[model samples]
Target: MHNFEEATSAFAKASDAISLKVNFPRTKHSAMGLKPYLTKTVWVLSVISLLTDIASEMLYPVMPLYLKSIGFSVVLIGILEGVAEAVAGLSKGYFGKFSDHSGRRAPFIRLGYSLSALSKPMMAMMVYPLWIFFARTIDRLGKGIRTGARDALLSDEATHATKGRVFGFHRSMDTAGAAIGPLLALWYLYAHPGAYRPLFLLAFIPGVLAILLSLSLKDRQPKPSGKRQLPALFSFLHYWKDSPPAYRKLLTGLLLFTLCNSSDVFLLLKVKQAGLTDTAMIGIYIFYNLVYALAAYPLGILADRLGVRKVFTGGLLIFAVVYAGMTVDGGGAWYGLLFFLYGLYAAATEGISKAWISNITDKADTATAIGTYTGFQSICTMLASSLAGWIWYRQGANTVFAVTTAGVMGVWIYFLVVLIPEQQKSPGQGG
Candidate 1:
């Protein structure tokens, strides 16, 4: 009961912290600059993402180091990440389809965030490989549950014209938390010097706050359809056939790109292998996210005005350059530039792809379409990470990166020649 009381108090405080007048006043002079493109729901959801990402990213930069400290090899780490991502990928489809089928979004959001919140503390409680995997899977399971529904909520909140700005603003806010979380971890690690366990518990604070904030969101539930069959585990796969040809074409390029774009952990590991300290590694990560946070919204606006296809493909080009740069023998100096470009790559592609997908799909199937795409994307990411890890183990990091750079170039050409032309002719080019 005392613990319950403490949680209630925490919720009240978090609610107050997020109140419009206090934090993001609705006035013209508001900190975030109130705009018609961003609605209350969008703001609320962004804050939830911001808080949740803080919790997740706090652990992210250190995860590889922590695993190594516990005697995990690079290959083992790769397998673990691959498996965890696979679980999240598969479930993203199922839950996304389930959310669409149920005509409700808020319940899934609430449950998902809560599970993620609980998983934060779970990581600090035990050191066993199975226990760690279980905790990590819970964290990713929460992500799978909410991503499609949450993104659909964002999609519903904006028109095709405004999708870029809305999603961009949300990404900006979310990445801001990503920046802040790592900084906090960096500070904690500086003072404590390798005391990683306590940081996991610290992450739980923001996660709980995210859950509390998410509670305020109310889904516009559609009236029930009469049929009552449950969605199949891989039912979201069916959307591939039902989706527009443009969506399928775009997704083909995207999935191919993902097949080479391995986990970011490999990047951090690269820095570590170069003899950089933990502080230096986290510092580089912090810089990358800061660049991403700063660039995401402005780039989103650009995508809206110029064209999402232009912006997304341009980002891919940057991605190729960054990967190519990664093949160089430069020290911290070159890494900073590469990560800056990488950040730009992330800002351009991540939200813009979703906005593009949402624009092309029927409104009713928004969740299913995105769920299926991301679900497949995640599976591809798993394979990519595993493959990169194996290559790093046998051949070398340079070979892994070189292969990725070549893949990105091919994907970029595919997007420009194949996907873009098809999108232009498609009926859904409204964005």
Candidate 2:
């Protein structure tokens, strides 16, 4: 039975943490010019993310192709993506809320990576699309289970001054693994053309590594605050009610943007449409990840310096332009530029959004807030993907891209009018 004043004070702390200027105390001798400031947990989590993404990307790029090979249509692929993401979305808040009550993050993380690792074998043995769906859902379930708890753990380990850098560094490593994975997948395909089974098996190695890496992170029970008994799961709804207005506002803005941003498989399909072979398509994916990895750290630092309000808004703008470009029947250069801009937009937005949420919630509710935010956003993305698939199936690619661009534009405007003003209202935070 926490009082409203207690909640208010905690909310104020969170807002201040997120709204600090560049003049805040910074750590020198850091890994990426912000070194000695970050903790071991951040680096460890980065390693875990890197390994897990390697395993994921290894199978992911090929899965769509395999689905098509097995007589699945684009709409089916979209539905599959939507359903899988919806499962992940719904699970995140539950796991996060549970983690807050239990106050142990490592178990959920270990279990998540292990489950995903096990799923690789399922993919390797798949002879039908349902098998693929089962494997992908299992993997995404693992992702859903770990993401909230892991992110909460990172925020716990980092100081306010280092939050952006910590998340950014993690994303860079994660994207680096994404870059490496496609290369490995490409090699396997090159060496053994049309042989997907071996590639699936090879993916198992990195997933295992990710689980092992989770062992490096430490977890502890919460200090006995003598609060009322907490429910095991679904308590995050209470967390939202208790959290600050700014957090909820930011979540709404992010959700708005995500509703228009569907699963990226369609983009891959677009690249294929643009005249690249399977191998070349993979090469471009590698290129996109490289750009993402390169840009994430710098953008993260920029977020810490300049404030996330503008950087995040700028990211939405990039997405809008990229989607607009995609609507056209472009040459190679147009598609390449679109993919590259997407990479830049990801660097600017993804980690920053998590960092933003982490900065705006109570310390005790970190996992709950992050999980809730990610969960809702992902669910919206599922709906958006499903809609995009329906549109693409019926109206064609031009209409789908144009509609996406329009949706993002609307979101961008909402951020400017509503989301940004709340942050600006606080003195000392950048606009």
- Report the C-alpha lDDT of model 2 over 87-202, residue by residue, as the tens digit: 89878988888777777788888898888898998877866878878988998899888988999888776655556766887899899999998888877888888988788788
lDDT of each: 0.83, 0.79
State the lDDT at 70 in candidate 1. Answer: 80
Per-residue C-alpha lDDT of model 1 across residues 176-290, encoded as one tens digit per residue: 9999988788778879988988889999999999999998988866658697788988888888887778888888999999998998988988888888887788789899999
TM agreement with the true structure for every prediction: 0.86, 0.83
Give the per-residue Cα lDDT of candidate 2 at 17.
55
Which portions of model 1 show Cα errors greater than 4 Å?
1-35, 64-79, 127-129, 223-227, 419-431
